[model samples]
Target chain A: MDDGAPAGNAGRTRPGPTTARTRARVGRLVTRAGLELAALLRATGPYATHDPTGSRAATRGLPAGSAAPPPVPQARLALVVATAGALHGAVMGSFAGPLGALYSAAKIPLLLGLAPLVCVPSFRVVHAVLGLADDEPAARRAVLCSQATLALTLLALSPLLVVAYASSSRYHVAKLVNVGVFALAALAGQLTLARHYRPLLRKDRRHRLALVVWPTLHLFVALQLAYALRPFVGNPRFPTEFLRSDWMGNVYLDLLWSLRATLG
Target chain B: MPAFLDLDRLLRGESTRPETLREGRVDLSAPRLVLATLVCGAVFGLCLGLFAATGETSDGAWQLLSSALKVPLLFLLTLLVTFPSLYVFATLAGSRLTLLPTLRLLVGAVAVNGAVLASFGPVVAFFTLFTTSYPFIVLLDVAFFVLSGAVSLGFLSRAVGVLFGDAAQGGSQGRAKLVFRTWLLIYGVVGAQMGWLLRPFVGNPAMEFVLFRHRRDSTIFEALANLLRDLGDGWR
Candidate 1:
């Protein structure tokens, strides 16, 4: 907005064009600033890596010997998930009856309490399955004992499950799912046993490959059981004897046919 | 194109469409299989006893021992059926069936099968009985076994014919001539089998056996013709 003065006179009054000497000085200052900025960036955390070198700083306030690095900000992740779940429960609750609403509400506390209990069976027993123990007899003994315990659990659980399932209006589909659940649990027991026992049995060294096969076998068996049992178990007070002959026998014949068809 | 190649191709199902069930036969070890079976059966028995204590149904511990005994018996029967015939066949072919490898192969296969059956058969049978009201699957499986038995009988017949052929052989020239004659008569019958009248008579043992028993040297050319047909399929 102002008029320009005479160039040489103004330059003399103020500063002249920068010479090579002054430019060199300015460049040095700029370089220093850049180095300082980079240092600041590293300290400010954006440029910092979360590798072994830098995580210590982030975990500084935590106490020593804490478990699993405390699930990697577990509280934050859990808080977000819980909030989402609550919102979901709200949507479900809007349509549910009083009993349904009550049941839904109880699930939150139940999950929180039960999640820790899961670590007990998993860590205490199953983790042993993958460990490097050469004691076959001991491993076998442990597996048998665990299986016995699990079998007992099933025995105890089945009656209660059957009773609850019987009480449900969805009894037909319920029994089928129960069959699948039973088969899966049995297969899981096999997997657990196989993991530990495989190293001992030379043939079972193939059990690592058996891992892929065994699950597939059980699932097929389950589906066949489901298809066969679907008609009978769904009906209460139905004659069990007649249904058994058709469904159970037919299923075996089909399996035998498949065996003959595939292997024989 | 080679006879050996044809044999290999037969085993691999290239020569036969929906290859003959005979293709599946392979050698197994006997003693190890038997041991495996016995151990498995006992383990299964004890486990069954233990589980019976916990499960809804109780199969007495006797189930296991009976199962163990039954499996080996089946093994014994299969050996009785297959081994004698196989030995006879090999003997007729001028091969020694009592040789160490042959004995090992035959015995091992039976034993291995017996062991596998001991482990798996009971479990399957129990569940089939448990789930399906009828023994429908068992019957179908039994039918397959029946078919296997017929095929075994055919092998036995071949074995018997070989024994006679051995008895008939006095010299390599005579034996070679006899083989050619026998094969020619067989093809003549097979060629006649293309007609309706011979169709019913084709598998008639009396007629076919006569062709084999009274065969002459002229049959070699027909066998060559068969080789041509076989190779043509492969090339196509």
Candidate 2:
């Protein structure tokens, strides 16, 4: 019986062809997913052609300069950027748990839906005040560029935010750090967009006004929209609610109060 | 050189030279030193536990285990309670040190305290063997703890002074001092509460040893009052 047991164990321990085949299949799937992700990031144009001339050349359907590659198509670029934004929001939301992910995922759509009604009109009014008629295309481009830059910046900073969230046991500090990271990313994105808008405003002396006005207006609208779509990152103080019952309370005030409580 | 040895030098105020402070920076960053510090803390805690269990001959081992465990737990709980506030206050005071380095400073201080406590262990053991009076033993243990804690606090203050010397010299010196004092007070209060929560560190010989005494009406303030009353009675 003992002699047969050794042989039986040897027979049972043989690696089957199915195991090798399954491993190969998994390897292929992972490679395919990675390639697709790379392609998606490339199409979004975050780290793409920083040369404005390249993008202008692409818009004119001309071959780009030797120094710069052709720009990605605007619609495809917009879609990818929006996707990145949603993904960033989702990752942030996941920090608070499952319900937070859902709340955060809804933020991108909320921003987009409100942009037409809020940001687009604000841009139009600014353009109109400056007497820059028929510059709707430029205005739209600026808006789109700003959104893309913000999304890309947030995506870039997501890893740091995730690390900070994961390492800390305290919910209050994590939430405060997350908010600080977002604010810093947003400020950086706005600066990038401001640089893009500078070329368009070269002829007008009052173009400087657009810089101040647009960002200020955008910030105001964004804050309001954020308040209305509360619980982007679920507060540990309260149970996960899809929306806060009261939108009247200011985030800054709440933050101060939380800081005080935490310190005490 | 081991970080704790360097720490001991710093605690003695014999090595305040800028280069020495910079060299001691490795203490906070080195994983080996961090591990050594924690192990030292545990060992010191064990010695304290043994001293605490001296009166309780029947359940000395159990009392020892409970007291030993509470030492590290008390340090951790106090740090958790005080760290965020310290970080915020330090930032406000314009200290250049980042969070990790600041945490290292605090941990190093605790490690220094542990070292000092371990050094005192033999003296404590001698006292334990000779003494039978409960109040006298309690007072001696408290005195040792207070001495160790003060030494640790001195180490922390000196470390902070070296790290933030420039900032302290600036206009924010008053604010920095205030922050430091406030943090010390907060640490004391939190430590007392934690000690209350992790009760019966020094077991009563009259009663059986217990890992935890069910917290009844005793707040930290009440415990302090009881200790004072015992001291008064002991004098009489």
Candidate 3:
């Protein structure tokens, strides 16, 4: 599972290809890139109203009471979450090998998609208690939008990950870079959630409370799950495993110990 | 987590607004408020105890446990000691607020305090990881406590002002506020003393694990002064 090997072979094979074969390969790559870009635009489009199932049209047919955008279909949003998550995860694990890439690709979609599922029931109860139950559907959509935004942001950031992995074989540096990217993406997601919740907030001030509480709950779960889903960068010294043996350890405590070792 | 939403409303001034307080009670669930306080307090306590856990001591785990338990205990016990006096004086000051509402308000304030402390958990943990200096972590945690203390007091005083702000109770409102101000000072001192009694929250590497340190001759203020001096010496 040597990551460098395939790229090294690609470099060595570049000059040996005949000119006609090179042109055909380049044409295929161009078509693939075009399709990927279209998919990305569809995922990240701020006003993605082109619902093929006519559900968004049905939403519009109802006399609109608020200026909030129509909710994207749950299935489509789930697709975006999984696809974008896997794209970023694949690059994140590229420093390991194909198997490592597959494992991470699978784990990231779970991270992006499942963490919110874990949080939704409690959040719904919170919304009900706050007397904002009527707005809960919109709030759930906001959450979905935020998750989609986070995944798309990560997908957008995968190139930087590639650059970072190329420059550093050091696992610690790789981990740090991954952290920086995720933090930036999470910030984007929070901002998106806030923006989406703004319409609801105007209708009811209590939505403001849920806006802050949701992120706090989400990040608490997400961070711990990330800690459990360790070995994302696959330290070169160790075998490329899906998780470390002691994956269930407390993340905050582990972070403290690591920091002390590094700085003290 | 819903309990945290109650704190969110408190911090946002939504729950403590003049209109809301006029209804004669804060909108906080009693059980949730207590749960939030304990969880948030324990979260910060875990962060605080990280210094010891990462230090050259075998009592690291015990330190975390003690610190977690002591933090909530420190705040709740301090409130228990000081609340009765505040309630009596507030009533004597011609306030119309009764016992249950006042207690709920104070508990809400403590939950806010806990929330603020928990938010700073990561920052404390970061510093804990970045430095092995015992004095520095102690001082850092003290500074955070001071900051959170000010926030909780601010919340309490504002809510009390609105609670006492009835047009008919104009003069007594000022008296109630004055009582609150005086009680704040007492609370601060008692909190410090209580924290001192619950010592070893951040386990010292030089010491072994103990639930309570021996009753010391020195006071909390003196210990703080010593920590400040020691921290300054380390810097130099």
Candidate 4:
């Protein structure tokens, strides 16, 4: 009996390396899948239209001249920005565990896809109100530039964020800092859009109102979407779940409750 | 109405007249703002600390005193750690703001934060007096802090713009904007850690009043996670 037990124990220990190998394989598969998805997004995504010259000319308010600038493909810009955002999210998500990468990966498309969509109606309204209906192309360019700015800013900040997360012993502090970085990136993008929109608004005092309304609307939509797609970064206390069971609650209330529970 | 009350106007890029920030035509000095900030911060901290210690406790006075001291200390330490780096970055970005004005503006920001905190003192005290739920009080305190901090940051942005004039705006001002955002991040991280280190601001009525607890191995995140787990279990 004792001999048999020893043999069984040895057999059990043998699976350790097998599991590790399996994990490595899984990681590779996930990476391959992600790349494929990115390529697909680049190819067929609605955001991947090729109209760089029109966008550039409209944003700069430059008149058409004999020597038009070369057209920059929108697909390339979208692909680059989406990849950067996903990478940043993945790096931050790694702090939680392997599952965090999946959560964050899911978040990337939602954020990139939804934010601009949220702003579209507002953009249309503003354009109509400002009597810039004819300037729709310019407005579209402004929006794209703003998004690209946000993505690039996030990409630049990712290294610093990774370092901060790795070094910080405190999870609360790290999480807060991560949120702050994201907020700053979003603000930077919005400001860039506002700058582009200013000349288009003809220095109207209503420009301020439009700026506030658009961002506020965008944030509200983004926050709701984020809440719905919960667990972008898994909580250390609980096992990773793709979506929280109680995901219907208000984010502000969650913040309040979480603060009370943790600090009070 | 005073310029400070017109936050919307400020957000629209309207500048507060220089006379408002000056003393009899003399520009506001760093030392003056620093002194004023410290005083206001102390008042705000005292109100919060006292309210936190209101539960039945053997050492209520000690708890209140320590809480007050720690709150202001958190702000002061964050400022000290971030100021030099911010100044260097601003200068590198070609901001004409000298060290003195930068210090004044930062300290003034803290003062505005303190004022906002004080404004919520009555609401905090009311909850403390009536509610025995510790977590609820803690959450309310945090919410208040976030609200005040955001308002203060808005003021800081406007103040920087006013001080730097046109140089504070446009693409060329990217570096300066980056520095400001970085400083805000640093302040937040340092402040959170400090708050964690000097914790139990609202003493558990059953426990003895100890100024500082023995150091724990767990990080604030770990503690938060554990608390959340406990709450989840209770709910289930």
Candidate 5:
């Protein structure tokens, strides 16, 4: 411990040519990944200027298809939802144990994916009824993109959950922490959605009505699903089951009970 | 399917455009609008009935059937009760819309209302599946009805404005617009009472499932106030 060489100098001396090459390769891979992630982050943000038709390619004197990235496919966005959702789910259930973690990892993606799918039919109807049927595809992409943003934001905030769990053993505090994380993530997703909807809104004022309808439907469904798939932060008083036995119970009723308990 | 397309066209404001209204008719098929309304009302009713169905009451199935049947009746009967007065006032105010065209326009508005309500069906059913609180569901349903009613009335109001205000060229048309506006209030009052008269839409968990509750002494407004107070009291 006492014989400390300079960190950078020591590493330089230890590596042979192959090791150095390997390290360089790894470094390049990491840099590439970092750039890709940064691009994704920028795309989701409101401030980023996106030209989906590859006009930037011509402007830069490159062939149109060569420089412009294709619009993110639904399959890839779904994959992002799955991967990022699983990561956040892992953190949420880390306080419980391995089995709980696995269960949560499986459920979070479903929560993200299914909630919107259930509401899409009605959303489509609303759009068609409002004479915005032609804009439905773009609107759907906006919804999916926002969901992906939500998942990524939740993943980014998972570290805070880890830290809170590390610092506190209180189960209720753990619940509050998770709730706080989710609320922040939801706000981020909503902002991204609104940003995505801005062009559509500019095209027609009725998109504003759709903007109101989507969240009302999504949140109402999501809340119940979240309640049903409970025990995310397992209580020490109970065994760590994937779902509580009374999983069919209502969130509104539980909330009332909690309020009464607190008041009494 | 064709009827649904017709309903869709009506929803797009195509049927109620200023030019279309100026032609002296709402461009909609009466049978199609009625059919769409029935399907949509039944869909919303099925969602409303989920509370009782999930409550483990012995008469849950019966409640479901009754609710499904009553919802269509609710709108149609409300229209029937309110239409005569609206017609009298509209004629008195010198609207050119004949009996059939006027009825068709009202039916189209109801179809819009039903469609909006049915769109909200999934939300209600989701809550009903999990929620044990009767007062909360009652309040939620009321809120949704208010929202859907507002939307439908907005559609009707716009059509009336086009028919009587923008299209027609006289001061008498302004009077026609006022008559329709006055009728909206009467429609709301009658609709609320009709809903009250057809009680047990969302069956109370504590009570046995009945087709209808005994006529309560209080008005719908008083009952709603009580529910609000009870809900605020933390009935748990």
Candidate 6:
């Protein structure tokens, strides 16, 4: 967890060593970073394609470049989200989660910027994956996903972010941010792809396998990606109520922290 | 010519005079819900702005611009989100209950939530002055604002469709499919429109509101003090 690619480029700086937890976080980060890197591999899964130049400027909705980049937007988003997560893990390992501190009402900056911005890059993928048939629906879904993602993620990360900001207590705000970042990335990307597959079962429409197989595979792949990296996530040690509450809140590590640290 | 919620008599209009609910009532058909939603949108903007302004640039000139403008920004944000947010919230919370009461409940919830979260943003910022620390509190505040509003809106979304079928028309909602199609429309179109309309007026500045100094505390305090100095209603 702690060693996870040093989030914001810990490679050059090199995060310090071991406390089983930090190591776990690092492992996850490293694996995720590896997966992201792997996606760009010449012959591989999600990151298989590569188009340096545009195939006549992506007339329809495709980008100028090929799918080769594996969606830089998603990757970039994952980068920021993951880095934030890494920062959070480091905090947790250092101080443990806190209940309250200064400016306790401030929203999670890492997340606020991360989720929406990241979505921007993958907006098309998500919209298509979700079930966008018409251009209106496409744009509409894109907007909804961003706004909804903002509101929901904000709601979801609230307690934990609050607990984190309020205390000098090293809660795993960074790690939480990463998990959130990835979960969102995977879901956003995969869900969009799923929608792409919807029209497929009948006939392979506009896209060949890009529409059907890619999204379908991506769903499993995203989950697998998240799961593969799960080993590195840290328990931010939040309060019980908050910990037990919310979909994202009830995960393994957070559950541990909430039960132990939370006043309620 | 939409309906409004006036659970209490204070807000006057063509009243049904339902004695049991509260004192006075107003036009249930007024566009108050819409207004409230817009205001909520504004508040969301405010909370977002304040969140952005957390750990700002140390430049005095920039600080001057930011410090001077927070309350107004918050005020505007609260204002903009008023109507849409109201509609959204009313839709979320009391899905089972009728419209007026639903809006009333939503209104009350936001008033409390906005005031608390808004006030709290600065206080948290104040205390956590040292670290460019995580804006955890702001995050919570955002949650408070969103969840409270969302719960209410989620509940009422269906009601919106049922009660104001016209308003709810066009948006798709298949269980096996997507939802809040209209939600997407309004936010994107409206948000974009609002952004466009306000952009020219808003001094093409970067939307760099989140800095981390807890401007909400001092700025809010200053605004209150200014209001007091003006004896509540001074000129422009």
Best by TM-score: 2
Candidate 2 lDDT by residue in tens digits, A79-139: 7566877877787787678778877876865664465457777688777978864654655
Clashing pairs in 4: none
User: In model 2, which regions exceed 4 Å deviation?
Assistant: A1-264, B1-16, B20-30, B51-57, B167-177, B214-217
Tens digit per residue, CA lDDT, model 3, B84-120: 5465446445455555566678888888889998999
Q: Model 6: per-residue lDDT, tens digit, A154-189?
A: 332333332333322233454555456445434433
Which pairs clash in the backbone of model 2? none
lDDT order, best first, reads 5, 3, 2, 4, 6, 1
Q: What is the alpha-carbon lDDT for the whole of candidate 6?
A: 0.35
Off by over 4 Å in 5: A1-264, B167-170
Report RMSD for candidate 3. 24.2
Q: Model 3, A189-213: lDDT tens per residue?
A: 7756665565676677898899889
Model 4 chain A: weakest 10-residue lDDT segment is A1-10
lDDT of 6 by residue, B120-144 (tens): 4454345434433233433343345
lDDT-wise, the better of 1 and 2 is 2
TM-score of each: 0.21, 0.47, 0.46, 0.42, 0.46, 0.26
lDDT against the true structure, each candidate: 0.34, 0.60, 0.74, 0.59, 0.76, 0.35
Top candidate, metric lDDT: 5
Tell me the DockQ of each model, to 2 decimals: 0.01, 0.02, 0.01, 0.01, 0.01, 0.01
Residue B61, model 6, lDDT: 38
lDDT of 6 at B171: 34
The C-alpha local distance difference test score for the whole of candidate 5 amounts to 0.76
Residue pairs with backbone overlap in model 5: none
Per-residue error for B32 in candidate 1, Å, reads 2.5
Candidate 1 vs. true structure, TM-score? 0.21
Model 1, first chain, TM-score of 0.30
